[model samples]
Target: MEASSNFLKRSGFLTLLMIFVLCCSKEVNIPEPVQAYEPHTSKIREILFIGNSFTSFNLGISYHLNLYLANDSLSYKPLIQEAAFSGYSLAVHLTNEQTLAKLNERSWDVIILQENTDIAVNDTMATLESIKAFQELVGNKGTLIYLLMSWPYKDQPEMLIPIIKTFEEGSQAIGATIIPVGEVWTAINQDGNPNIDLYNADGMHPSLQGTFLAASMCYSHIYNQNPSENPYLAGLENTTALYLKQKAN
Candidate 1:
């Protein structure tokens, strides 16, 4: 009887071990997630946003960007907080030691800059010249430059055409990408948002909804992800679609 009991106990232990081994042996393959953009080969070092009132839309675009990125994170890019101010001249930004200190202290992976609205629109050679100087000063080590294109002035929408063209040229000169936030807004604003204001009360800055839209557009490109994949895009798409429909009506 003792021998029989020992045999049974040993057999039970062997069965358990076999089961555990089997569980560990075969691996289940999880579908590699498809990113809207290819897996980021490089991590984003830092993102510096420089613009006048439009870029500074203060807790507007930046806030909404964080909200979307924080909640629905499906990208491989590192978190890069924005550093900028409203009505900031390119020359002033270049001369500002504090601003330079931030870049010098940390290696920025990307810089999305926007010249002041007037400077960008007024055909000011100085603005572009300052940008050239600033670019050189930053020592273009491993940074990607980009221009943030803002929306048309509600009162003078035509004034934006030249500016947009010029910005494209400037971006070409600097080897930077362009985030056409203004065009995105124009597409969305065709529909009347009865109570929801798209631009700020001043009609120059972006309203809450406007900021969210800008954030969504920029985030989509920067992270190489599509907004359709983004959860927030649903709302934005719905709003834009409705706007288009209303235009048809």
Candidate 2:
């Protein structure tokens, strides 16, 4: 009788312990599954611009591009970001920690690389090497790489020849698309619109019109659509904006 009673007590305790454990488990909250970090929604296209002052001047190309996109009735939205600094070349970017961090921050849909104007003209080999390095880093992420061709100085029109050649060679060597911004600027110059000035007083940096033109060209090539179609004037006069869009198209 004593053994049977002890057995029953032990069984009762064991059952009680299990019940307590089960109750505790039911009361405790289990965490939901962790999701990966996504910077933008699937409906948004992210573009990262890596360049120098030419890219950042006048609030940057991405700024105007966003303005154009915002005014359009497109299916997908665009989110543009930049890691541009004054006088920073592709070679300099490779060595800079901040630039490296920005490059690896996210899987961008498109990465636009603009080399320093002087490096592209004088050191084509270096430019190609930097482009190759960037290509390797980008890998097969389905990200499109493009070179934003820099325009010639306002006073030195002859510089455009070598600059164009360098960008062409770099694009061909790396299998990247060329934005041809410089070419567009050259065409605009030939058009002889005194109302449109592409260069800042320094003759190196781009003026507001130059930046608008660059942004328009970028919009045209990146979207495979005509910039003239987009009604965003980017704060410019209607006639001037229309003229720039026509040239970009």
**Cα lDDT computed for each candidate against the true fold:** 0.65, 0.88
lDDT of 2: 0.88
lDDT top scorer: 2
Stretches off by above 4 angstroms in model 1 are: 1-42, 58-60, 72-77, 191-196, 232-249
TM-score versus the correct structure, for each prediction: 0.70, 0.80
Error of 1 at 203 (Å): 0.9
lDDT of 2 by residue, 113-220 (tens): 999999988999999999999988887777789999998888878889999899999889878999998988988889898789889999889999999999998888
> Least lDDT summed over 10 consecutive residues: which range in candidate 2?
35-44
> Which whole-number lDDT from 0 to 100 does residue 106 have in model 1?
68
Number of backbone-clashing residue pairs for each candidate, in the order shown: 1, 0
What tens-digit string does per-residue lDDT give for candidate 1 at 213-236? 666666766766555444443245
10 residues in a row with least lDDT, candidate 1: 240-249
Q: Candidate 1: which pairs clash?
A: 46-109
